[model samples]
Target: MERLYQGIVRFRESDYQSHKDLFKELGQSQSPHTLFIGCSDSRVVPNLITQTLPGELFVIRNVANIVPPYRDTNDYVATLSAIEYAVKALNVENIVVCGHSNCGGCNALFAPEETLNAVPHVKKWLEISHGVKEKILREYPDADAQKREWMTEQMNVVQQMKNLLSYPYIKERYQEGKLSILGWYYIIETGEVFSYNKESMEFELVTDTFTP
Candidate 1:
């Protein structure tokens, strides 16, 4: 806790001071251009990875970076509510679904039911992406653990991108070319990011000169 407080002090003295005007302007209103949906992993820092400053990206993070298919319900839906506000209210032009290598949520999908039972809520939340494991098994029943892990991470990103389209506003904007949806797979240790290509159905390396 002290470490976090010290970090805040450092930010207030250094990074915050340097960006004082930007912060001041952001205090009144924010018009972020993208909605970045990423995992709740400590290592997956969306702003740091994207090199985006304040008021540029609205982020929503959760276990596995899951995006449940659009639904009408009276229940409390935190992730869905955030998506709605970012799109309908904030009018973000882009939405990114980022998944990373060696994701614990991905690993959790393959865990035995007995193991998952211990974390009931997490188990229920991950059910949204359970089809990812089924698809991998159906295609490569003999795939080893390493192969399965990477595949799960990448496939989960694409699955969430599809799930995002299930939202009526997002789908309309997407078809009208008013909105862009991207699926990214990040390799933590190597600091590499791969963006999915809808045309080729592959994840290609994102380089300095890369054009999406």
Candidate 2:
């Protein structure tokens, strides 16, 4: 806690001070161009990775970076509300879903329910795993594998992209060509990002020239 406090103090004295005018302008209001959704893992800092300053990226992060299928469920309503606000109100031009390697949530997906519910909510949250789990079981039932989990992580990004499309406002923007939805995989160890190409149904290396 003390370290966090000191970091804030440093921000106020240094980074904030240096960007004081930009901060002052942002204080009036914000119209960020992107909505970046990623996991709440400490290792995944959206702003740091993107090098976007305050008021530049509106972000929503949750366990496993999961975006549940759109429905009338009481759960995930808050997250959906944020997405509505970002796409409809803020009119952000981009929505990026980023997943990272070595994610605990991804790893834990392979474990049994009894061992998982030390935090019941985590178990429930990752229940987004249902379809993916069935796929793995049906495809590779005999294997114990991290590769299977990795495949799920990749698919999960695509699935969340589908979930994002479930919101009508996003769909409208997409149809009009005002917005782009991106699914990204960030390799933690290598500092490389792979982008999902809808046309190819594959993830391709994001070249160095690419901003994302």
lDDT of 1 at 31: 100
- Give lDDT tens digits, candidate 2, residues 144-163: 57777677788778888988
- How many clashing pairs in candidate 1? 0
Give me the candidate number with maximum TM-score: 1
**What CA RMSD would candidate 2 show?**
2.0
lDDT of 1 by residue, 121-206 (tens): 99999999989989999997998999999998999999999999999999999999999999999999999999999999999999
Q: Would you estimate the TM-scores of all the predictions?
A: 0.99, 0.92
Candidate 1 worst ten-residue window by lDDT: 136-145
Q: Judge candidate 2 against the unseen true structure and give its global Cα lDDT, from 0 to 1.
A: 0.86
Top lDDT prediction, candidate number: 1
